[model samples]
Target chain A: MTIGEVRENPAPAASVVRQPTFVVEPSKGWLALNLQEVWEYRELLYFLAWRDIKVRYKQTILGAAWAIIQPFFTMVIFSLFFGRLAKIPSDGIPYPIFSYAALVPWTFFANGLTQSSNSLVASANLIKKVYFPRLVVPISSILSGAVDFVLAFIVLLVMMVYFDTLPTWNIVWLPLLLLLALVTSLGVGLWFTAMNVQFRDVRYAVPFLVQAWMFATPIAYPSSLLGEPWRTLYGINPMVGVIEGFRWALLGVNTAPGPVIIISSLVSVGLLVSGAFYFRRMEKTFADVV
Target chain B: MSDVAIRVQNLSKQYHIGGTQAGYKTLRESLVEGIQAPFRRARKLLRGQATGAAELDETIWALKDVSFEVNEGEVVGIIGRNGAGKSTLLKVLSRITEPTRGRAEVYGRVGSLLEVGTGFHQELTGRENIYLNGAILGMKKAEIERKFDEIVAFAEIEKFIDTPVKHYSSGMYVRLAFAVAAHLEPEILLVDEVLAVGDVAFQKKCLGKMGDVAKSGRTVLLVSHNMGAIDALCETTVFLEQGKVVDIGQTPVVIQQYLSSLYDIADYSLQNRVDRGGSGRAKINYIYLATSDGLPLQQVLSGQEVMIVIGYESQIPLNHPTFKLTVYNNVGQPLTQFDSSLTNALFIQLPLRGYVGCQLGKLPLSARRYRLHASLDNGVELLDHWTGAYSFTVGPGNYYGTGRNVVGLKDVCLVDQTWQLLENAPEVHWSV
Candidate 1:
């Protein structure tokens, strides 16, 4: 008949514990990125990425070698077709080593894009049952790609040794170039994955998008084939700059990343920032629709 | 050090359904609609029919204007029937989904245990999954490590801790998951009906761990249909029905409201209910409870005579038909059954269109709600095995006397028994 009033205690000082308090409410406006909450679950991100890497290699006979083998075989296929039959020029370098350099970054970007795009839907059970920054799911999937990139990079090193190609001062730009590829992958991945949760057509569109994106980049051939402002415009695809930078950094190719690097960096940062906002915007409906 | 742990404003969430927004639509359809949207708007404007009044627009407000608060170190219970917004309220509090309108603010570190071992990888080792599950439930890496040995010891999976959980037996798997969940120390805890799972020992273990959490002075909000647990732990309970709060008061008062709101009349139309099995040759139309005088009965005492009336219509004539009526406890454990095959010779055959009344001499059930399961068959092939028929409630009062009673009543069933003292003692025969 009556609502129970909370009885006030006289000795309230002993029961009051000082701790951090966070409020949850409906989000307003366009941008709702909670990077601090994501940072709080950084260890969870590490464990998730670790779990993905561990599970990917488990029960496979070839194990981590699959990472190297995946990029190696793709490079072989491109060389056999584009180099042997199509006679595509490799900027005065051997086609195998040249294609291998580009494939390393290309495969990393492609894998990161595919995986992170499906990450939210893939972890729907976790999202529905618990609360963490949903950003961790996609970000962790992207982190796992970095491990594969390291393993696949070893093959590029071996191929360079076989061709006796020496590294140039451009090699110093490798880490920054790798980061750009990651940013671009995450940026596009967030868009596709967020839409994928609602429409599911984005799931089928992803592989097609990656395939189309691969050809648009200069993977088998050199970007030097393009002249003038066209070369700069090609950087709009983002991977063009990444692949060209890879070839220039490791093989010391004359086709250096000039205005393309600037364009790629700017576009990738824009994609990363914008994609993050869009992902956060759609995050409100993920538990229901997913 | 705020006294209130959670303050929920007029939180409301609306869900779109049954139209272009009913379920997930493909991108192609959405793109086509996007492309045609402007032209369709123009045509609608020309015709003056743009408001879509002729369309069947559907939406569900899972939670509407729900407001409540729990103070520091206080335990609150939310009780409701299925689809009563109990789970939705918890989901909103845990930040799994944002409200459509209004807001809710939660203080302290919140740990929501809606499902056990969420995000656990089967390919990972038991040791690995413990850490993984702990982290997902919001425990820190160092905290999981500190309790790692205790959890493994509690789960008794130390011998196979390094083995992938896919190889563990289901029992071991749940034990490991529960161990990790029990160790999750948070400032505020939101628990669903996760305790209503596994074997008796596992439930006892969960209750023990929950009691520890309560004793440790943490804020807890539990959503469960188990009134016993709620009554024992929570001083205040909130009753929700049809997406709105019906009452929020002391445990007993709200629980009384919850019970009175269930199965008070012969309300369900069984003919239209789809959750059933077996052939449809003989279908049950409706079911209800009645007294011996054929009066509609809502509830009965522990020792009162009860009659279960089942209405059915058969498509063809049945010879030597078999019928059954079953009683189940509130938690859905089957208590007893009255099968016609045991006494089928009483009647030559069941009628094609009529009511079947299986009368009970005296109901020995305790004071609680009960559901029914009934079936009918034309002698050999099963016709209908209706699993969840109309439900009824038993009494909070006395039973009829002057009858030999059943002994060893396990508190779930009432059995009238006599207690007497013997005047003489018999000599013990101890032959060594």
Candidate 2:
């Protein structure tokens, strides 16, 4: 279908202030983001999120245990290699407590990347057969990763007790940081998932990207390794603020991640906005290319 | 719009149909085209020339200038041969894909069983998948809870509901999927080709459920290859051809128009996509059915030659073998059996054959679609046998004028004729 004359309705737009166009014309011009329509389908978002959770744990020998085990064992390995042997800095907190806190968010990000990157390809049958907002597939993948995030947070609680550390008033900011991480994951996920549908090379590229990203973030080491603007520069990774915010909230860092956290938060939101725009732009090609 | 359940005006979807090369354009090609595009556009503007967007290369309209509206509670069947844009139209209506040209507004909550078990997890138990699929099909958890028992009973998987679905047979999987889709109520239901998966009995059950749904006043859009199912369920049918609405009218008339165009070779060429199954493992060139009198008939008269010829490529000699052919009806029921092992040509062998012709003489059959099932094997050790290889149509016929050929025959494969003249019929009074 070629682009035709644009038709505008006088209906009031939703909270997302943009001229919401129901029709999409690929040949005409730039793609417009329709958050209003997406907002209407929010119930579908919840159902898809629920479907992902049920399917993930259904019939698993470990069931929900795998969720806890992933972050927990990761805490152990980081403790052995980076904590005791390598003598990596933990910002004065017990290394075990420090790494476990970072592992919680890192695991969510890693899992989100893994699931969302393959989502479109994995749901090829659904794409070819039926119609729905294709973005729902990857978005649900990210949301479901939130389930494991909450479950793994329990282990972080136990680590806090073992360290005899209680969360400070700063812990109120934890939800905001978690939102930052979520936005970041969804952002990167959208880009990779759309690419994965076309190039298929993204499947192999994802694991490598995640591994490099983990070391790049302060998951195993502290952002302290790269001092000053570089650390703030490292905040460009976005997840740095999320992990450092958890450490600061639970372990009480003297500096509240300060400029680094702000930089990281801003970068994370930026990634999310740009990723979504790219995804919306490329969405029209998916049905044909996939 | 009369509170239209679904409305579309000039809905069109454009697909690039990408080239074989990755990234589509190489760096050098992009460089050359990049340099040429600006110059061409500038030259055209300076010379007061015109540019036609339609001239875009490799551009094909999968759906073009399509428009329609469906009232709530209507059962509409989208009928067309493959690539006629029926699926694309459905996809746009369901919002699976956005329309490239026009606008479509679907009122009320829409539930699409686009494919059976669209989100079914293999590792999940049948019970778990019920919940997963229910949610995927847009059902609330409480809604699923209310219908859980009915769904289980309908799928007939109560005994193994707790077991992982991966362990269930393909039939069980489809049944559970159908059950979930059937029980969940939504304002509108969009079903694709899933009905073709389940067995005959299950298909009937699904049809019955769909009939109930229609009576309950919910919009239903069904797309199926089975004309019989469409005629029985859909009150109106829309025919699509080459991405255009060719016809939309009463079920029978629309179907007649669609099938009437099927005799031409173009009809067959448009649909066949080189199916790889049954005889795919063996090297076969062509397979066709011929009458006993050596006449190639598309519509066979009952009690005519039902011979099958198989062309194959063989590089080496073959041993003493038996060839078996079983004929099946359209519904996959075996109507006749002809095994070479039972005939005198049991030990025949061909040495380094290039092309071979085999024949079966048959003068008995009922009016129906008969498929050719063939197998070539040395006794005991099976080489290859094509199960449900080819199909031909058999028309009803009367063999005898006096002794009605419809004489009751013991064999199901036997074609017996029967006739009676109402005026000449005799009536006898009981001697009480």
Candidate 3:
């Protein structure tokens, strides 16, 4: 009955400790996105990502080869439909290399979005049972996609060699383009992930969203077909810049990336910031609702 | 340098109750509610009412104004009945869920074992899962690496470490998971009923490890229904009832208080108790404890005559109805059951409404609080089943007439026994 009267004392022993104290309470105002806490849990993030990568390829016949096969097959299908059937222009580059280049980052973005959006629900066990930065779940899912992207990138290089269309020095911009793709995926993925926790309809909607988004991006076709303002507006879908930038950089395509890249970069960063805030807002409710 | 490993002040968690749907609302329910919101508001406005029964505020506080402080190197036990918010308190302190009001501050690296192997992937190998589960429990990779060999050796699964966990037997899987958790080495540990799994030896090992952890000057908060473990391990105990702390003191005193409270409910009316389940063709009305001579009894001594009177009603006539009365110990483990059908008393006709009494010549249970669960069923169909329908206390008595009392006995039951010794005949039995 006198539990409240218990006096606090200094910890005994002379060992130096680095643990930080924390206060848990209901959200009162705009919560800070404690990036420091997430940084401290960075090792957990690495293990989680490693687990996802290992589990994805476990008990499989093709193993990591499946990563390459997914985008390669999608590229074949897009080439047949858009290039051979619809006669869609590819800015004078071979259609296979053009679409394959776009699909490399596109697959990474799509897979990252789909996986990260469901990451919280999928790891509901850990979310409810243990305390960790919930952001680790979605971030690890996105990070795992980087492995798939790297594997598919090697195949993209092979395709470029086969098509006899090598890249110019523009390929130096590939890492920046990959980073943009990552940011864009994580931003939108965070929003969908948080929403998925409340309404599971987001889970079923993600695949359709990815499919619709792929069409909206200029994967099978060139963005050059659109005019100036429309092309600029098309960059509202951040993958437009990523895919266009990939084509421009990898295949030495003539697609102008100046205004669209700026618009898409701004959009990607904007989505990242806003989505992170929204995700953090819903973060406290996740353990209860999930 | 704060010695208070955990401090909770006025911490509470509110959960909505009494609705057609509860907790997580599915999309369909939300959609329907969304569509009907305007009409519901209009009706409320017309009635000059500000709220409805289905409003979100129709809530029950699982933990209300609870305040507790755990000092360094203290192993505190939280003892309470089911739904007493013991788990909720641990969950709040562990930061798995945010408290609805007030705050809880933990001054150390808190490792919570709310469940063992929480994030273990069945498809991953045992070695891989160790790293994964350790990380999920907030252990750094280097920490896990340092303890990897120790964990594997402790689990005794070194031979099968490379095999996927899904292929391991249930026991092996649990051992590996528990080994990783045991090596977490957090400054504060919060465990909730995780010892209920695994075999007896493994549980003993876990308890020993927990004891060592406590002795190493780290704080531990354990929530368990096992009075034996609580009495053995905890220096202090907190008893909760209906979201409020009823007692907080030495372990033996609090546990005794908890046990005594169980005997306070002499008669339980089963009519409106919503925790019952079954087809509802027949429903239990009321249950009471009595003596063999039909005298109402509240508490009886062990090995004394006792009877359980069950009043029930059936919508239709039941033939050869089986009535089962199961008794469980204080920790929710079923001690024994008495089934009418199991005996030779079969093919008995039952009226639409009547009272059925099960008379025991001598209650073989030891001195402890026990729960009664009753069910009325036909051979073909279940009519009604009430869990925790009633609870009673069995005080100690000299069942064998040995002039010795078994009050405060820890064993579950008492058995009659006799021993005889042959005088002066066993001196030459040592031939090799």
Candidate 4:
């Protein structure tokens, strides 16, 4: 007999001994987190983040120096327009260092949001071709911004020395504050990236949203300009807590944004959980739509 | 360890076709739809109250309840025409897209190469891209590092390893991409038509590597239009048509089924087919198949007399018209051609509108389905051409009247011959 005939007859025997290792089906409900899958693909996340950093500065003469240039120039512009021209209050600190402190985290947050929001559409080819936790795309994009944040942070340290303003013990909260910025950026980024897959308008809307959000945050002016209840309400924008926290921790400002930070932290966490659920809901359709 | 490598049950995927608000709607379209949505819902509710049924008419089922299973260490080939959901099947199996319904269970780590150079960044160096692409294909960093030199040597681009991939030649780039993919070492490898790229030598190398991969007892699911590769590698093949499994069995059998289905002609129509190219000065309105006796023949026996009738409409009268007709065998290989100019039928006057018949006293073909492609050209300007305009089948026939059937990989023609015994001469040569 031919091999096909022999194999066909033994198919039942072959199937009886089979045990599947992975089963794929339509995702149901909101709890399709699949965190273990992401953890297993962690190396891919690292490589992707590395790729972004490598490709970003490739062929550019300044290389990683562009990271510092971007925020430094923005700080110069803000200091001239808001600090010098408008005489904005710096909460008893020098306005250049004051705004520069907030701008450090603000730049990180803004860059993270812009990159993560467009990550899905930018890597549509990878998403369509391979099978990975789609979350890795936006997450890695947000993480790659950490490189720029670090480069820009070094420049901020140099500026702090130039201004001769030493930070106090509150600098210990810097890591926690940075984590808050990371979470808040990823939270809002997930929603926009997921929507961007379907509606391409999110790509156009993101930069505008970042611009408006900058004004809404206390980067140009201290949160001390407002009173108690209104100030706490303004903390609904997550960057308010992150920027103010940066100023308080780095500049040792006397404003003490206690209630605002608490409210902003809660709001940021809430955005993350809801945004993740929405992202998971739209994840299955990414390959089909994108 | 289980014997079954993959199992798919009742898998289906639906797509909305040409709907104003389906599948990646733009922001403007979404906004417009959002504005009109309330009115649409109200109208739908009113219509439902009247007719008790409201159905949207834009959806099409790309795959419909398709079911199949593949055993471990088996190399299975999926063959189909375009839009047959072959890619869709691979996509669903690879988890690139979730199925709308049903479940596919994979027994091993599935590494899918849907396209080579999937995530290669042009700005990145070749070495960096190798690691990046390997990681994208689910290879661990340690695994990629261990096989790094082997991959580079296999790609034959060791000299350009540190250069940006944008500086590499297209051939070199494809080689590196395919090398990384081939060395992926996943228990189950899913490849989709990626071998169709690169030069002939590279393609041969890829095929050889794939053969080696199959021999090493890894389950491979491949989707390709290359019948030679499929026949050489796969023991069993699945034939899909219109998103459903039509046949799944031995490679040759399933391949023959897929080939014949291309010319099945049950629902085939030449009208309104947009796959033709040329200036449409003259058009073939209809094509007909008939026997020597002038009877329309849907099917004919091998070595029988046949005629192909072509009816045309021309905007202007033509002079010195020539017609060329080519017959392609079951595997889409062009076997023979009958050109009017080559047969000394050139320089004939042609009217603006008339039917032309090309007759053959005896059809020199084997028993198989053949596709017909026809084109008309004048001496100065070409008129029109239609590819795959019609198809017909040739059944088994006793051309020699010996009551013997010619079948199964035989020559595609019946040649008359005489056999003589050389018994007297053989006896004289016994000394040797």
lDDT of 2 by residue, A143-248 (tens): 9888899989988887789889888989988888888888888888987887676567789989999999888888888888776768778778888889998889
**Candidate 1 clashing pairs, residues 3+ apart or interchain:** B18-B22
Candidate 1 lDDT by residue in tens digits, A1-290: 12223344434566555443766677765655879889989999999999999899899999999999988998889899999999999998999988999999999999999999999989999989899999999999999988899989987888788899999988999998999899999999987787767657678988998999988999888888899889999899889889999888999888778899989989998999988887887777788878
What's the fnat for candidate 3, on a 0 to 1 scale?
A: 0.78
Alpha-carbon local distance difference test for all models: 0.80, 0.72, 0.83, 0.82
Model 4 earns a TM-score of 0.74
Tell me the spans in candidate 2 whose CA falls farther than 4 Å from its real position: A1-44, A54-65, A72-77, A225-230, B1-7, B16-59, B103-108, B265-432
Among all candidates shown, the one with the greatest DockQ? 3
| Docking quality band of candidate 1, CAPRI definitions | acceptable
Q: Comparing candidate 1 with candidate 3, which one achieves the higher TM-score?
A: 3
Residue-wise C-alpha lDDT for candidate 3, range B211-280, written one tens digit per residue: 7876787788998876656766788999998888888989867865665464573433332354777888
* Cα-based TM-score, every candidate: 0.73, 0.67, 0.74, 0.74
- Mind giving the per-residue lDDT tens digits that candidate 1 earns over B186-214? 99999987665556677767777887887
- Number of backbone collisions per candidate: 1, 15, 0, 0
Candidate with better DockQ, 3 vs 4: 3
Residue pairs in candidate 3 whose N, alpha carbon or C atoms collide under 3 angstroms: none
Off by over 4 Å in 3: A5-20, B18-57, B265-432
- lDDT for residue A159 in candidate 2, whole number 0-100: 76
Q: What TM-score would you report for chain A in candidate 3?
A: 0.93
**Interface CA RMSD of each prediction in angstroms:** 6.3, 9.2, 5.9, 6.9
